[model samples]
Target: LIADEYIKMSDGTYPVLFVANKGRNVLLGREAVMRKEKMQTNQIVKDDELFERLRALRRKLAQEQGVPPFVVFSDETLREMSGKVPLT
Candidate 1:
């Protein structure tokens, strides 16, 4: 899939892909340029304050439920949540 559409100075020099399930088209190369720009600037991607708050919440919930923090929510899930910051 990459080799077919790969292009330098246009679609980005590196590949950053995420294939969705249910045969959905994810616009494979669309974000490549944006990601490349971010990578070049050494961007701080994660929202540290929100992430820490989520971790603290996870810890509290875990303690209350008598299970590990990961059992409540994985770190990756928290990171995604912090990145998106969904209101609902």
Candidate 2:
């Protein structure tokens, strides 16, 4: 079972308890279960490559239209498109 909050102790620590069959039990501390979620996973694209290509295209279009790049499209919009990888 997953829990949202932990039981705190006197020494500024938290406890995790497991109760088992026939009154068998185990206890672990907060340090044992706590871990940082991996943010830079292999599945995510390298933003620099995608963003650089997008910015270059935007700059070229802006120059042709005689306007600033933001007039064509914002970086955030381009980043969202990169994230979605939409075809056509």
Q: Which residue runs does candidate 1 get wrong by more than 4 Å? A: 1-44
Residue-by-residue lDDT tens digits, candidate 1, 1-88: 4443332223467755644331133355434332334345433536899999999999999999999999999987888788887668
The 10 consecutive residues of candidate 2 with the worst lDDT sum are: 21-30
TM-score of 1: 0.47
Candidate 2 lDDT tens digits, 1-88: 2233343223336654544322222244323344679797444444767877998999999999999999999977787767776567
Winning model by lDDT? 1
Evaluated against the true structure, the overall lDDT of model 2 is 0.64
| Candidate 1, residue 74: lDDT | 94
Instruction: Sum up the clashes in candidate 1.
Output: 0
Number of the predicted model whose TM-score against the real structure is largest: 1
